[model samples]
Target chain A: MKVILVGFGVIGKGVVKVIDKKKNHLKSKYGLDLKIVAICDRSGAAIDENGLDLKTALKVKEETGKISNYPEKGKNMSIVDVIKTVDADAIVEATPTNIETGEPAKTHMIEAFKNGKHVITANKGPLALYFNELTSYAEKYNKIFRYEASVGGAMPIINLAKETLAGNEITEIKGILNGTTNYILTKMEKEKLDFDTVLKEAQELGIAETNPHQDISGLDTAAKIVILANSIMNKNVSIKDVKLEGITRITPEALTMANKSGYTIKLIGEVSENKLEVGPKLIPIDDPMNVKGSLNVAMLNTDLAKEVVVVGRGAGDIETSSAILSDIISVYLRTKNE
Target chain B: MKNNKKQKYNNFNKTLYYYGENMITLDLELKDIPGELIRALTPISNMGVNIFSVIHLREKKTDGRVPVRVVISDAGNRLNEVINKLEEMDIIITKVNETTRKTDIDIVVVGHVVDTDVRDTIDRLNKYGLVVDLDLSMPDPFKESSARMKVIIETDKLDDLCKELDKISEEKNLLFIKSF
Candidate 1:
């Protein structure tokens, strides 16, 4: 599998590690030649055309915290330059989520499809923002666009909604789609931590970003729900349409009192009855609604059945990277040229 | 005639409540033992509270416990009554949370060693401070036939429920399933 990775952040780095780890098994067993030919960060880009040295690149990342100073073996280029010019099977679009306009990643996804390249991404903003248009473009260009990691971290929710429940009409979809918010809420309830306390702890735990409004304010979940709604319904939806809520308003006293009251706090995103809203609400102690810590996400009220809830580790380097690999493998299978 | 009208109005002394309002559904968990579900629910039902829907599916865990999902009418201050009833019943509840419909939250109080004393968990939720809103029954036969229930209460009480559930679960050999 030949590929190019964009934005070598934590998740992107994880993907590279997995590919490196499995390269031997894939080659010896399946005759697969996994190659990450190019890597690009905002500062600079490196292209080996053959393949970048994964070991040196990783060491460089560990040392400098960036994918620079690796002796620049390949043709050094810009991210846009690499995306436009690279000859790879797919683009791993793991850029920083630009929620405002969904710019570069969105544009880059289009470019990849137009240029006959498939896409596998963990960027939620672009998918949530342009699900309809992009899916249409994929169809137009005969490309594959897959984003399982965008929501539920590593949970196979996208597949659950699209493939498993394809037979059902899927009248409703709901879950605690954000790990950061759920972690904060859990800390607040368990350690008696407040939102800010839990939130800061989340940052220390590497579960949240420095400016985590997207995760804390429920915007991340809103984007995820919008993506699910659009994917299931196959329509173009806007974030504005989904009701939004954040954990910032919650207090320690409230969580403590909620304990006194027998309720758990979770930031939820729901879409059903032709409407979607996102916010924190009190869930019962045993409804499978109050999944705690970083493990969460559930789907209820499907078309063919009553309620089916799926749970697992919602976030992890391995899990998220595996999702991206799934996207890549899917693209490889679809365009295998066999 | 005017004196008669004034007297009639005074005699009525009735409180008016508006209808057609959306009710938030809350999910709750308690002991699956005997008399627990009724103890958790009767207090609220007698207070004129309406239930929207109840989903009771025994978790199918070998531990012999139950899980219930429920919806209720979210009218006026009915939340307070529901919370009081669950606390009274020692049942732990989370706000009945849904999306694209209404803003609600989901909570749970998991039980372990449920095979022996099914009602022990729910009984604890009914005691004090912890709020509850709904109660349900599991459908499976030959499994003590525990009830599945959903309840809604305030968000602030979540930690207290976890602490209490942890404490109870520790002593009772209960499987404190965390809320999703």
Candidate 2:
């Protein structure tokens, strides 16, 4: 499987590492010889018609923090150029998310589809912003558009909904879709500390991002819920439609009060056909959704399967990349079946 | 509600097996010896038969021997080997019952379907067999409402499923009426 990997960020590097580590295993187990044909980053592009040396490319990126220093590095070649010109089976889009515009990643996805290439994106921006349009484009071209890593990292929730739970109608989706806030909440509950103290600790521990507005304000969860609503629930909803509420108002006193009532405050994203919302709701402490640390849990309410709860690590380079790799394998299997 | 730490089902039940191999219950008589029960189970486990329940009917024993009932599920034909091994150990092989009987039944559950946790109700029904379809009517859920559910289950355990539904209905103070 020849792949055009766009973005040499943490997730991109993680995919390269996985492909390299699982080279023989993928071939022996699944009969898939995944190779990186083109690697494009913000700095420059690395192109090899046959297959680029992934190990050296990764080492170069690590040392120089650039893909342009890689062997046979191509200049003046845009991400769109690689998607259009590179001879590959799929495009792995692992760019940082820009929920506002869905940006260059969205444009790259459109171009990949236009060029008759399959797409596997970890960027939630494009999907959360224009899921219908992009999915239609992929379907129009009869190509696969997989983004399992978009919502729940390595949890494989999207595939679970689309495949495993296919026999049943998913009535609603509720989950903890952000890790930073969850860490804060867990800390607040455990130590009985205020939100600001927990937030500072999380920042120090590198759990929360430096600019934590997206996470603390619940916008990140809103984007994820929008994606789930659009993709799984088949709802034409956007972030604008979701009633967003952050954990900023949750105080130690309130958390303790809720705790006394056998409940814990968790930032939850819920999606139904007609409704989409992300807010700090008081869930029973015994509920599986009330997990500790940065663990993410998603519960899908279905008619047949009942309430199928999926818990997973929602972030990390390797974890998120695992989801992307699974998507790649899914595309490969689909193409093989076709 | 969304807080993100992600994990998935490590031991996912393979629903595909339900179609090929049927669930079964085994009844055997074994001597009241330390290794006798263990010896009888070696063959069953080796054959990859999933044991559902193992009931040692000690009170119903006769002449230093006890009747043991084992409920297993598998698609493979390995019961002969199991019986042969039990016979070698001087254990009696009483019966081997397969749960392949199929039955389709429709049920109407009344009163506050959503407020009473309809998802839990559907999930409970699905544990028996396949919940074929469901039609819910809740014009106003705050008031009384109902759901018409269709289920295709193994005929042998139809009564068990009904009893479970009855318990749920009684506990929730709802009406569970099975329609022919």
Candidate 3:
């Protein structure tokens, strides 16, 4: 399978490393030989018709800070240009999310579908805003679109609900989808520190971004839930439809009070029939949803199965890349016969 | 066949019937003090209700109260009477059968809890639910103070209580962190 990587950030670099590490395993286990035809960054794109050397691509990105610096195969080309002219079977869109306007990534996926190529992205912006529009384009062009890594990082959700639990009617989806907020809240409760103090410590440790507005303000979780609602539950909703409430006002005294009542506070994003909300919900201390630290946990309420809970690390370059790689192989197996 | 008999017990001399074969459960919250458990169960016994099992949820004891689940048989039509008698004795009945009749909701209010007329805030919330327990901490009067309150309300009125909290939040510039 020939693939194009649309972003060369941390996640993109991880994708290259994973593909290189799993090259032999993929060939031996599934008889699948994958190749990277193009890797695009802000500077330009690195293209190779036959296949790009995975090591050299990473080295160019690390040393020169741009994939376009690859020996002689690199060129100054736009992502759209590469997607439209590149001869590839699929394009892994790992661009950074723009929640306000699902731009760039949105256009990238649309162009990939129009140019007769499959798309496997970990981008949440386009899916949150233009989910139906993007999916329609994929369907209109008769292409396969997969984005399992968009939500819950390495934790399997979109595919697990839509595939493994196929027969059960998924009634609702709820969990701690963001790891940064979970980390801050956990540290606050454990250390008896104020929200600002704990958040500062987290930002120093790189668990939180310098500008952690999206993660702490519940916008990130809202976007991810919107995707799950639209794709897995077949609901036509966007981020605006979510009733959002962040954990800005939570205090250590509040956690103590909640502990007295056998409960803990978590930024829970819940989507169900006639309800789409993201806020600090009281989870029973011993409940499956009360996972500590920077771990993400989700509970899918199904009609037949009753309830299913999945817990995993919600962030990390390689952890998220693991999900993207799985989607890549899935696309391969599905379209291999064709 | 069993005979239904009228019995007079206690100082009130209220006529109670010892009859029927219905089994029911009462989730009662008792003060963590001596004789409170026996005091809660005596009312049902006075109504000629036979006690089946009493399970003490010791692990769930919070705020100086212990939850006791009492199962009784032979109450039948006297179930309401037993509930009324318990209420008359100031015993908190949290649930009847598997249905939650009353629930305790804990909320942490941040902002000028005392400056914004905390009494009025409690009074307004009391319209929908009883604000039974309150704990306030003010690290500095110039800064926002946080208050934790436990409101015992009927399960059906939860939505109304939340709506009231939102209204209070908007009116007084207070943030209510609620446990639902």
- Residue A222, candidate 1: C-alpha displacement in angstroms: 0.7
The 10-residue segment of model 3 chain A with minimum total lDDT is: A253-262
Clashing pairs in 3: none
Residue B154 of model 2, lDDT score = 58
Q: Candidate 2's residue-wise lDDT over A1-338, tens digit each?
A: 89999998989999999888888988999999888999999987999878899889989899988888886565557888889988988999988899899998999999999999999989999888999999999999988999999998988799999998998899999999999999998998889787888899889989998999999999999999999888888888788898776877665655654554346678899987655778777676677888888989999999998999999999999999899988999899889756
lDDT of each: 0.70, 0.81, 0.91
TM-score of chain B of 2: 0.44
lDDT of 3 by residue, B1-180 (tens): 123232223322331232123557799988899999989888788778889789999988878889999988857678889999999998889998889999988887778899999999999989988888888888888888888888889898998888888788889999787665
For every prediction, compared with the true complex, DockQ reads 0.05, 0.01, 0.35
Q: What is the lDDT of residue B151 in candidate 1?
A: 30
* TM-score of each model, in listed order: 0.65, 0.66, 0.91
TM-score of chain B of 1: 0.41
Docking class of 1: incorrect
Can you tell me the DockQ of model 2? 0.01
Q: How far is candidate 3 from the true structure (C-alpha RMSD, Å)?
A: 6.5
TM-score of 2: 0.66
Candidate 1, residues B38-83, lDDT tens digits: the string is 6666776787777766766565211233445566666466677777
- Which of the numbered candidates is closest to the native, going by highest DockQ? 3
Off by over 4 Å in 2: B1-180
Candidate 3 CAPRI category: acceptable
TM-score of chain A of each: 0.92, 0.98, 0.99
